[model samples]
Target chain A: MLKNFADKPLVIGVTALNAIDSPGPGVAVIRALRDGFGDNIRVIGLSYESLEPGVYLHDLVDKTYQIPYPSAGAHALVDRLQYIHGIEHLDVIIPNFDAELYNFIKVSAQLRIMGIHTFLPTHEQLDARDKMNLSKFGEKYKLHVPEAITIYKADELRKAADELDYPLVVKGKYYEAFVCQTLEQAHKAFYQLSAKWGTPIIVQKFMKGTEINIAALGDGEGDCISIIPMRKLYITDKGKAWAGITIEDADLLDLARQFTKATNWRGGFELEIMRDADGKLFIMEVNPRFPAWIYLTAGAGQNQPEALVKLAMGEKVEAFSEYQVGKMFIRYAWDHITDVSEFQQLSAFGEL
Target chain B: MKLKKNIATSENGFIFNPSTGDSFSSNGIAAEILGLMKLGRSADDIKQHILNTYDVEPSQLDRDWEDWSMQLKDANLTEL
Candidate 1:
């Protein structure tokens, strides 16, 4: 169906080269895209474990394939890509892993040479995914950013902490962060995360406020069509939005517009913002891909995954005019069989 | 196992508690529970209705409804 944009059927190679069972954000996006585009686009799910099949693939994607991940370098992944290309004519590649994204960006041109389009940002553009780099970008763009510093070693963290206020946040360079209530907690978090990730981390002054998220899709140039601002009313243990509302905040939307234009960002992006007690908005972090709640926004009205896929295919996309402003969604997972357990673990629904 | 009082929920799902100044949003099921609470229905009564209408088993509904109702109370979204 997407052959008009390319030379063949819209076959998107999806690399979930990480653990595939859990309902992560990338997997959620893959599901949404499949649902929206249907058989018009073929999906090739590449993962590590042979049995680590993705959830919702049966109902969503065209075909599901599992590929073993290379422990060392890019050889296994590239081989798997060649195998996928052999099966179906490839049109686009969606890398669902950060590590895979790093590899995919390098070979984006090669994939294009084979008539495949990928929505990956450039190497310099990938810095937007890093929290520390995002903070600096926020500062550079004159966006309100919290007092923050990135440190490589634990010794440097201590010195930076001494200069900053207490009750700070120690965050991974890429994906997660934790708020440390005390210096002892911060020190512990720094060691644990640094040990696991093996990189410099961000320590920022913890700002108290209502957390708001602006999720949108840019055309990879400057124009953005949809603006979905959600207020995080309830939070989970992992800082995911348990329940959120689609709020019509012009100020927040304007900030997103300004920020995207400043960054020249393209693709699906979710930016976390903090509305402090003083009514000041501060940019928190930028996720290069869709959020776990991407489907919620799609459900609410603005289908970002479909728009993103269309944009990647070089189609003239429609601009989002309005959205269902107050809808909500909840994550659902299966659990062990029990009398009362079924209801407890049944699909959770939340206010959007 | 009963829902408390004073959860002022609107038709549009806007929930406001004057005592705590806290607000929340409820889905269709939650709105139904709130309406039942307003009518002075017991937890057992609501559970019976839920199981009768929905495909859910009784005990499972009982636990989640109980916990969620308690959370409403804790959040000061309930009158009690």
Candidate 2:
């Protein structure tokens, strides 16, 4: 049973409409929403660029509106959203991009005042899971995390690498990572990442293991609503999961619960895990939003986005107890044929 | 000749190892062997059943059984 306002379809706005090789979760989340609400929900696509594939996928997205980039600051973002809300009367706005989440969180109260609700992590929760602060978070929660050292300068990388040893991982502040086996490669990675994503490069100890991912939803009260662990069956060169299978892992579920309990994680989150040969699970990273492959959770019987919507609406929701063990999701790319006129309409008018 | 106690198999050759959370699909011969293993059939009993049911030389069956057993072991579907 889905809820609608005054017998009208629930208008929900979603961002990160890019569904490419390295995709965002917007499309998948929208699919789950459609599955849950069917004709009862109206989707408004929020895009930073006009060319995002979701903008042209008219069948899935009812309307498209161009939003300002996160660099425009929270005030500009709220101003844009206020304009969109005036027309669309959005009931919920799910900001899916990591880069834009800070602004969304900042303007969440303002959005609420305009009658738009969002389920997102708090500022403290978001900061605790930041790439640079993961080690400290892990230590505070008493969870296993690989040793990592943050270096602001390339010269500092040598000492960090020496501490972590060779064949370590060099990571940028926000994104990009390289597994460097030698100091030379580490320096190259440090310079390259710093050039693109800025300094304070993170050099981490390399843990040899099978990588597993857990997509989870929390109720903002230290309660885990759903958790689905997946093992990547295939990976792209960019380290994105091309194909994955849902798995049953008690330890992985326990880790998700522990993280939720410790952080009181509000919205959807993903835990990048490394299970070593000795069966030790380490917290590799914590993404503060639903992952691109979030549809797999619905396939496995959780329907996390739907649950998240209910949570966002302040409805009483129950925790999901179990899910199918062997469900799999294989992602593929398809060419969407669309007239350039639709692109021009969105670009010129800022709405389509 | 023994599958793990918690290993679940379907007639269509889908096998699930709950302990490791790994799933696999097998060909007809492998599925047959897995079914026999689940039924607690001994190695000789499984070999005899395969020889009686399928058209294969005993030596070829022996080699294939060894390979299949190794695969099952590697997948952690069979108890040592």
Candidate 3:
């Protein structure tokens, strides 16, 4: 009971192949694609660096191509992707990096001319969840979010210091966050993060509680296609969930659906949640794209990425009724032993 | 430098320190160098061996050797 965008087999491309301590969602996304399509789909691995391990996972990925980094801007990315599309004739391109989503959404119209289908949120939906605008979003939706103040200049942190107590979180625009006990530590994290990820760094009240993550997919019409809530069981020093377990929480699912209803969210998203001692849940962050732990969705019951592909193809899909409870996912690293010849081939030619 | 005791290295490039219960994955070159270190090879010997087997210059390999040593130390996978 599946339909394809075309008569011929479909070729789909995904980006952000980095799967290290700070894992990217590409590998997990690809795995979900395989689970959904089996041998019917051809997977194209789109990556920024030559050393992204996913490119060399020949079994999981059919072919690999290196694309320009997001820092090169959307036009360069569009040009590079067009070149790759000429050879690959990709039908769907699922960009898996948060930093690159704006570029992909910007070119979604242009990409459609080449028959490349992308199902993503509008720029407004993406901005509604931005860290800088999160407070406004909460006020509009009546959702609970942590108290956060964005400071453009590091010195501006002092202006907001009196309002927030010590041991707040200093977060960059795109990535990286540090907890500062003293104002000096806050200043240090502010400068260090701003220099790397640019301005409007966020200083948030550090909430102490259990961290929960919910990865869900929306049908673009305010209907949630799937929802799975997982609590972090173990975390690496980098703050990535090393291991997690699915839990049965009706409140979390209700909140996730309410979020989708409020925004009419389209495509995949992950919500970073903090549950206080009083059983109050505060939305800490809203990642516009799928989290690195997305494979758990497929593992639990719903293949959100697969469902996303179908929706992108303009196909109707039923909402996932349920998922397994108490299911666990433990991430482990493995050495992918491949010759330097393959690396040389891709680095020099931009294709493999 | 020598690899820590109870260290296990897999051909898949997985390194596990049984004592610490920590696991790590490495690239091909790093894994090869680690295998050499596990056999009690000197830094110079390992560098020469890598230079012969891989397409890296001696100067660059020397720098990478130092970096890998630091990584090993940081991971607590080696004894000096």
Give the candidate number with the greatest DockQ: 2
lDDT of 1 by residue, A1-352 (tens): 3457334447776655232233346566776776787666666655544333352344444555555443445666566677778877777776655555667777677777777777656777677646777667876888888888899877777777777777788987665688987778888888888887767899988899878888887776776767788887777777878677677666888887887787677777788989886678998887776666777777778888778777777788877888876666655554423343322222221000
True contacts kept of 2: 0.17
Candidate 1's C-alpha runs over 4 A off are A5-9, A16-23, A49-56, A67-76, A336-352, B1-80
- Per-model TM against the reference: 0.74, 0.92, 0.80
Candidate 3 residue lDDT tens string, A1-352: 3344356667999987899889999999999899888887889999888999999998889999888888899899889889989988898999888889999999999998878899998899999999999988999999999889999987788877778887799999998899888889989999899999999899998999888899999888899999989888898877789998887778899999999999999999999999887778899999988899999999998889999998888888999998877667999999989999999999999888
Candidate 2 segments whose C-alpha is farther than 4 A from its true place: A1-6, B10-27, B42-70
Q: DockQ for all models, in order?
A: 0.03, 0.37, 0.01
Q: How many residue pairs clash in each candidate at the backbone level?
A: 8, 0, 1
Candidate 3 predicts chain B with a TM-score of: 0.90
lDDT of 2 by residue, A1-352 (tens): 3355558888999998999888999999999999888888899999999889999988889999999988899999999899998898898998898889999999999888888989999999999999899999988989999999988998897788778898999998776699999999998999999998887888999999888999999999999999999998798887889998888778999999999999999999999999998889999989999999999999999999999988888888899999998888999999999998999999999999
TM-score, ranked from best to worst: 2, 3, 1
Best by TM-score: 2
| Candidates sorted by lDDT, best first | 2, 3, 1
lDDT of 3 at B66: 87
Error of 1 at A23 (Å): 4.2
